[model samples]
Target: MFLAAMARPRYNSAGECTFDGKIGVWPYVEWVAAQKESKNRKRGTMELKPSTSVGKEKSREYLIKYVLPAIKEKWPEEDRWNTIFIQQDNAKTHVDVDDPYVLREARRGGWDIRMIFQPPNSPDTNGLDLGWFNSIQAMFQRKMPKDLPDIVKKVEESLEEYPHQRLNRIFLSHQACMREIIKHKGSIHYALPHLKKQSLEATGDLAIRLDIDLEYVEAARVFLATP
Candidate 1:
């Protein structure tokens, strides 16, 4: 199973807030189970669960309770015996430097599991992130819930009814895309145009400016060192 963590802002519709409105954070934990085939082919299941919390601590607790257990239940029996690798990005909620629950679980499982962290700013590397937001958006479009309780109920219903086969098709497609990316030596930019476009569109204004400034500062340091 490949796992990825993402966050989307929660809004209060009764208060007439924007989609980006912050009623605290709703962190989503997505799990995809893939079965490999010959010649780099693969297909599998996908499960998405939204975990709510007013703060980071509560969020982590929610993941431990609701998300991880579901993942454990769905884990392939053979893979559990073999080396199980859990891949996730370096989100603060996902993995706190001081104490990461996933890592802790891996240790408790007698090192039967391994945790891999993707490179910074590399959401495309994880296929779960690719179609996750679209699924959430589709759910949101169906019914704009009045309050948190309504939103939670709607989200639960969506997850329970989400088609696993469709998710498998998506992962198989992503596996093919990944193979091509590997052929080009992991240059994600060249492999997936749609992912790049989605990533760019998702980036916020302040984040873009900060990234540009950071690049400039790093380049200036390199020039100084050369002199």
Candidate 2:
């Protein structure tokens, strides 16, 4: 599987995109040189092989080596010193937020990077899982990748080519989903909301965040307070 990190796209004062929000996407594979010549290839040809082990060690390695550095390099300079939260689902392979090595690496360069999990049992709250992955997958499938290396290359291309504005729209949709979750008393059974985002964008009325009714906030508070 490919691992990815992204954030809501950022725009400057004149509304030009400053950051595209694609920290990076990394495939969980390594190149292994063939030991013996085969009909398909000569000996010593390096071939892409999917990782056999994907546990906490591998996950932490990806975060420390790839994700963190990408964020450091690509994150906006103005906000680099501010707290940056890396959100991941509560998969068993995911490192704990407080893993010592992770904490040390996250604290490097005086950047306040931190890790957090998505809301429990609410995978839809993640912008990637909510919409961006689907967008990337759609684009990647259109490329008709023919092999493992091709798949990786196509996926990375898809991610790079994906529009930043569409990504921002997906993040807004994520906020809308969170609002719905609160309105539904933390339930995930509700239908996904549609905002006609493309039309809204054309009209220049697309919102960075959806407004929530005060009553909904109160109701969610009450629900949280209940036994």
Candidate 3:
């Protein structure tokens, strides 16, 4: 999912916006035919492509062609001074971080872009997986797409309408989940901490950044050093 459908949220209480920045969604599927004709469309005619196995090569191309350019284009120009990290779940099809082509492309146009994998088996580490995807999935499910194209259209609609503030909160939750991981030595048994961000925001008390306590940082470091 990209930012094109909606604007990226501002961290402050004002809920101000930078721009109606959009990173358009890139569906990887090519049109394919329905085995049998359906009410939606004729058989063998153009339709949304189903997931046709994203191999490493395709992932690389996606990063190069779609993801990176979107970031460079949609990302706020003022915030381009630092590295941009695009996180992916630990999937086999994801390109290696150090892949030469990826590294080269990431450094293109003077941007310090990079890719990183979410912690294995830790869905909490992925903002989308933590909540956004589930929320969209629920909405998409309600659409009850009869065919793959319908599914794509419905899902795209779901994503486009998805609130940017909610997306930001999910990312905040993901950070809190990481803090929980540090406190628990990477254990998944920790409960999600409730921030009541909306209330905090109402009072202008919401923190834009979640600071990992010193002990929590030390704990994570020690745990990593032990192995």
Candidate 4:
């Protein structure tokens, strides 16, 4: 199944002892989708970091033109008919009230997509969102950006500096967690806590369980039959 995750990039400025900052930086939204493996294996992530600041119009265009197409390309031919599991946070840009254009277009596109929202204030449930941002923050922590352009440049530089092996490891870690969830019969709480802890430990034990027994008989049957 295609498991997707989304997050927003916030811009904050430093302030002096008794002074207020004047510049207000705009927010940027990012989305990533990956194929989940049996033993919590994950493929490379296809991500979208939009230039347009967070808004309905910008979000709509980016999703329709970029994110949707990238996700569509990743689905297997047989699984193309299956609904894409889009794990979305409670972001205003994602479920905007002002414009329903993106929703309408998404429905029209041949993407069988559904939003899987996490509980409010629950970042731990979404691992990739935490993983990617943490890597970026670690890379850029030594310097402060003066403006949006500077921020973007630093982000790009960090992305380049990041090793492919690190990303592959992240994807694999997420895949392992998803497998645990499936094994535990869609129980996010059961899988996430352990996965989070194991990720910090960096042990390859995450891939140990190849088959998780599904609570639903039909699900187990389908999973077994899928080859």
Question: Which candidate order results from sorting by TM-score in descending order?
Answer: 2, 3, 1, 4
Q: How do all models score by TM-score?
A: 0.53, 0.87, 0.77, 0.49
In each prediction, how many residue pairs overlap at the backbone (N, C-alpha, C within less than 3 A)? 0, 0, 4, 2
Tens-digit lDDT track of model 2 for 1-227: 87887776777656788888777788989999999998999999999988888888998898899888888888888776677778777677888989999889989999888787777888677667766677666765676778998888877887788888887876767767877898899999899998899998999887643345532221111000000
Off by over 4 Å in 2: 140-143, 208-227
TM-score for predicted model 2 compared with the true structure: 0.87
Report the error of model 3 at residue 85, Å.
Answer: 1.2
Q: Which ten residues in a row have the lowest lDDT in candidate 2?
A: 218-227
- Cα lDDT of model 3 by residue, 1-227, tens digit: 22112223444345565543335555667766677888867777766664577678877877788767766787766667665666666767777878999889879889876666667888776555655467656875766667666656766676677766666565567667877898899798888899897898778776554455532221111000000
Tell me the deviation in Å of residue 173 in model 1.
2.6
Q: Write the residue-wise lDDT of candidate 4 on 1-227 in tens digits.
A: 01122211111233111211011112354555545544443565554444435544655555566555654553345445665554555665564422366556555656655544554564444544546567656666877776555666666555445543343344445555556666777666653533453564376343322233421211111000000
Off by over 4 Å in 4: 1-53, 74-78, 96-100, 145-147, 157-210, 213-227
Query: For all the candidates, what are their Cα RMSDs to the real structure?
Result: 20.3, 6.5, 6.6, 18.0
What lDDT would candidate 2 get against the real structure? 0.74
CA lDDT, every model vs. true structure: 0.41, 0.74, 0.60, 0.43
State residue 189's C-alpha deviation in candidate 4, in Å: 9.6
> Which candidate number has the best TM-score?
2
Best by lDDT: 2
